[model samples]
Target: MKKLFTSYLDTFKGLSKEIWWLALITLVNRAGAMVIPFLSLYLRDDLGFSLSSVGWVMTCFGFGSLFGSWLGGILSDKLGYYKTILLSLIATGIGFLGLQFITSFWAVCLGFFALITVADMSRPAFFVALSAYSKPENKTRSLTLIRLAINLGFSAGPALGGIIIASIGYYGLFLADGITCILAGFLLIQTLNPKKAKEVDQEQLVENPLAPHKDGLYVIFLIALALFGVVFVQYFSTVPVYYKEVRLLTESQIGLLLGMNGLMIFVFEMPLIAYMERRGWNLIGNVIGGLLLTGLSFLFFYIEGWPGVLVLGMATATLGEMVAFPFGNAFALRRAKLGRQGAYMGLYSMSFSLAHIFGHNSGMQLVNSLGYNLTWAIMGLITLLALALLFYVKRRANTLKI
Candidate 1:
């Protein structure tokens, strides 16, 4: 175990301060995100809210995220990433603290929206900073390191959050989240020591607004990603209610099952991404593979009384994510114009926001109307359609290559 741990530590030795800062921020940010896996539980079990109402809170959060990501991209260039990161963390900390004291539905809804804005706004800036930090050749590896750290935090967070909620309740969990966020903010502020107003302007003057590779195929890739986002976002939105109602899992069991995704991501994501990097296969193919795996995984819900089967399905789906996410981001960054990388990535980030709003609203309605099993089955079908679109994009990329 010591030897294994040493190897993990070795990977960090060569990275620059910028990369380390990004990874640390990811860990800190996601520790706050720990609440999400259990938020639905809190709403339903603690607050006596309906699933549909829970969906509305999620939608409002998504709406705030959409605005936040847009603003982050635009402002990160103007204000610098360090300021954006620090401000976002402070805002998120306050929001979490507010959540601890306020239980009213409207007020909680407002808090959710505010927190989501702060959280989402920080994401683009973090990515932008990391991309700036790494050299071109090492970009994918650096990004993967960040993903691994975030998932590592996520892997520990939900299970820990579950225990906290089960033991001290949401207040304890909320306070811990708030505290960690403030620490993360301070760490970011001290580490980055960002430039003043004029330095940001000088950097912008030299950066090309449109330089990443421009092609129609990239747009097609983004569209396929948007569709996949719909199903992906449902895990936090409706899957909890489905597991509780249809599968007869308790809150703790649901938390365990959700944590399984983070565990798989934490364990397998880097190696899987590394292998895919070597495969030299067009990423569009891997995207389809990811969609198909995700679709198939949902089908495991049909297995009667098999919570373990659901675990395998989620693990498989995460495997797909490990592949698809990095590839898609790399593809977008490579294809985007240099100066507008933030803009394109920001728009790409919007797809996730849109998906959350659509997924939560639609998943709740569909589950209520069509039953949990059917709702999942339909989500599978949406993935299949996304797979088909990706297939088309692959052919288009191939033709262009030829």
Candidate 2:
């Protein structure tokens, strides 16, 4: 037991203090990320919006994310990651604080679009910062550490968010979200000078970094990523509705269940990643396996009538997430040459943004028309398609020496 504990602890070693600081900032920001998980419920129950209406609003949210990601990439390259991140954090905080004032449907749609656009601008900049702060060899573990912080914060956020929502309503949730983001921004400004971080080795930099749009294989990889995101994001967008309506769970109960995903990742993911990294396993192959597990998670929903099946499905999906996301991020980062890291990471973030645009609205529309079982089935089929595309990417990457 002692040896086992030490081994688990060992996985966390060798990361720089800057990485830890970055992780801390992420933790603070994500811990207040209570709004999005409950956005659909708030729209439906509080504002009396229909499921389809909620879907449209969320689609607008996706469009905002798409634009923000592109802009962030450009800013990260032009202004540097530090300024880009700091600006995004402060702007996103102010946006969230003001968002609660817009109540009408169209106004709400516009509000969400504007808020998410500013908020997601942080994504690519954050990735570029991660690269700047960590050693080349430790990059994957560094990403895993940041992900752990995010999951840890997410695990706590939802549970507390449920309590906050129950006691003070959605306004309190928004207040918390805004305050935390601002606090994180201040924290970033106070600690960690970006100037002192490790510089990209000139010799290692690609002389001609391929533009992401022009890279066919990378585009294929992005499509697969977007599809995987479409399947995965259903947990956030539609699964809560399924929990409330079908399982008849309360807001608190739903929060706990959702929080379980982060808890599971926090407990297991780092160790698993360490083992995988040590083995030098193929990143794409691992992603393929993760996608398969994610697909099977949805298949469990087909059984129905038993709420435990929901738990099982969530577990399977979380395991798949743990396996796939960090490695996928590392793979993307590795593919980016130093000069154009911002563009590559931006497109990488955009794939998920694209997923957000189509995933939520489509899932909700399908559920409204076909019900949960069929929706899950369709998501599984989508995963299969994503997996097939990934196989092609793997082959092409080998052939192209990418």
Please tell me which predicted candidate would have the highest TM-score against the true structure. 2
CA RMSD (A), model 2: 1.4
lDDT of 2 at 137: 83
Model 2 ranges off by over 4 Å? 195-203
List the lowest-lDDT window of 10 residues for candidate 2: 194-203
Instruction: Spell out the clash pairs found in candidate 1.
Output: 208-339, 210-337, 211-337, 211-338, 212-336, 212-337, 212-338
Clashes of each: 7, 0
TM-score of candidate 2 versus the correct structure, residues matched by position: 0.97
Candidate 2 residue pairs in clash (backbone atoms < 3 Å): none
lDDT tens digits by residue: candidate 2, 265-369: 999999999999999888898898888898899887678677798889899999999999998998898888634999999999999999999999999999999
lDDT of 1: 0.75
| Residue 70 displacement (Å), model 2 | 0.3
Give each model a TM-score. Answer: 0.90, 0.97
